[model samples]
Target: MTAPGGNMPRREALPAEPNPHAQQLAEQLRALKDHGELSMRQLAARTGYSQKSWERYLGGSSLPPRAAVAALARIRGADPVRLLALHEVAAGTWNNSRTSTPAPAPSPSPAEAPESAASPESAASPESAASPESAESDVLVASGTSAAGAGIGPAAGRSLRIALGAGAVALVLAVSSTVLLALRLDAHEDGPAVASPVPAAVTTSAPAPVYTCRIQRVDGLWYAGISRTPDAEVAYGSTGPGVAEAQCLLRRAGISPGGIDGMFGPLTQRAVKALQKRSGLVPDGMVGPLTWKALRG
Candidate 1:
């Protein structure tokens, strides 16, 4: 039966037994979506997959590709390996089912039957004709052998002389070619050598130096420094070298803090909030010890 909205019924309610592995994977994906508080549309926006595709996946109507599974797991911070294993099992089961399906038996072509049945009939004619032809061939061969034994005929002697003359001509042509090749080689050796043009070397730009983030206590306060230490709170509207360090760290964590001008702004706040959410902390748009630890970690 069709669903109330006229959509196809969900696979879960189907009569045929559902694939256990596919059902399990769909359950895990549903739980992950709940944990991330993400709707199908939101997931599509984040993962570039269509919302309807995700619906089919969650509804257990179809198996998702491995890449889709990986992308979902990455967004939800779930274990991709486990999900992929389930996908593999489901994919294998699908493949086996398709392979096990019985195919229609092949029918013999009309031309094949006629050709097979006519083979013996055709072969008998050739066999009957072969006997007389072979006898004639044998008589001819006996006559030729007797003629050859009774001293070479005039035609045979003429053929031998022609063969000898052709051999001599061939030998002469070969010797002439060899002499010409040697002469050419000697002339090439005597000539002055010509140098080939060399290609210019290609130069490439060097890679930028890597910035290592560190936390250190300086004087009487903490400062977040690049390749140094961290001992400061970088909140909205904060400005200093510490703020710059925080921005750098956020950028390193794949978050974009608007600028690295040592000024904390809304962009930086949003990045911090994202990090906080991922780190399972309260996202108050504040960069405290926990936020710093999450960033550094």
Candidate 2:
């Protein structure tokens, strides 16, 4: 089947750290679409969103907006409140993950800087050598004064240590966040789950009934006739041979009517509506003359 928009590029692959909440919501959306037996285009038509948008949402390539989620839930007869809650959670998580601060670059230590511009060779020149004793006395006095000034008070030293510890803690947190993001991505990649196909029939102890109808054309119109009239309207909740005939025609048109038990249920109605929409007729969930003709093809 063609994607909703013509010749659009495929969506990018899902990120490594896909938001778990978003993945859950996407899975639920897929399940609902499968239950409804809807194609992307059909879903788009019903939900007023593009088929491409639905594809991205269902594929987990992007988190759908709240309005889109609600629309899809309504179409699939699901609980909008629950789905929207999931959306909100996923949206918040995704946003937070995206907004994490980048780790700071490591700063150079004080020892890495140059101590002084003067070299030992320049200091040991003849003129300096002549006053070596005086120079040595001056150096001793400066060293003693420097040592006294460099001695930090106990309280100041303790505060400095506390500040350093806090910086270390902050650095650790930043590193941990990065690692966690990576692990989340890895987990998501490892557990790729595809949605299971929708069951053709609901579980029941009783065997399902089979239906058959004869197709014929008369007066340039086609019909799947099980009755003398051959043009009877079959709608939801309608039963008997005519319903069976409509179901048969629907099956022939490549649309499933849930099962051919001769009962017009929701599945049958949806099939009729889909066929009507495809044939450019009013999709009122009723199998009228135009729908019958289209299905008979």
Candidate 3:
């Protein structure tokens, strides 16, 4: 059921991207934030942090404190392990941003370079240079010698090794990040967690607001026009607009999401699995980018 004239107030965009490393951490936090459907005020009230601080953390402007992350995990019923891992990795960038790097040793001046290089050659007597066949070069020259005996200089060799090492580390991080994200999503897709407890600060007397799934087209994608977050991970414990959006997409695909009450329960999980199985996805009950793309498509 498409709502042709569906409208939702546009939300303010987040600040410009933060450091590359920090951005990944921020994105995960944003997805969790969507899961709870909490406002900045609500998050601040719960975590005892200022709303501005949350804006910085969620916008990737700064690294969040460990305690703050833990508090949010508790509130959202997240496992906290993955979030903490991401935070630990992102902290490298945070710490580096504050620390100053030392400059490299200066290269010898051009005038001094020639003299310094020539002194070694000048030191060798002509008698040693006139070595006939007594030098060890006879074997090397016959079997493996080339005129290219001069290898990279010490400075150049060190730089090359450092660059290669950095590239390898970066590749490892990229792979690890992908696997961890998949594992986290897969881990969350189960029977809903037994919520431990809601802190008094963030607790409210009012009932959770129900969202209507106003399905519509935008940029050639189907959106609920409620949260308008296409990539947020929606799992068993998730709620709010993300849930409503999934429900609408499930229904659009001709599977009932048990009527879209904005809570993620057994029926919605089944609907998600049905869609994944039909679409040839892995059929993990959680809805991440791939599942969301299938839904929108």
lDDT of each: 0.63, 0.64, 0.67
Deviation from native of the Cα of residue 78 in model 1, angstroms = 1.5
Report clash pairs, candidate 1: 215-229, 215-230, 216-229, 216-230, 222-231, 223-231
Strongest candidate by TM-score: 3
Q: Taking the tens digit of each residue's C-alpha lDDT, what string does model 2 give over 30-137?
A: 778767777776776665555555777787876665656777787777788888788879967865554453222222255532321144533444433333222432
Which residue runs of candidate 3 sit more than 4 Å off their true CA positions? 1-204
lDDT of 3: 0.67
In the order shown, the candidates' Cα RMSDs to the true structure are 31.5, 29.0, 33.1
TM-score of each: 0.30, 0.30, 0.31
Worst lDDT 10-window in candidate 1: 194-203
TM-score of 3: 0.31
> Across residues 75-123, which tens digit of lDDT does each residue of candidate 3 receive?
9999989887878777666555533342232334789668634765424
Could you tell me the C-alpha RMSD of candidate 2 in Å?
29.0
**RMSD from true fold, candidate 3:** 33.1
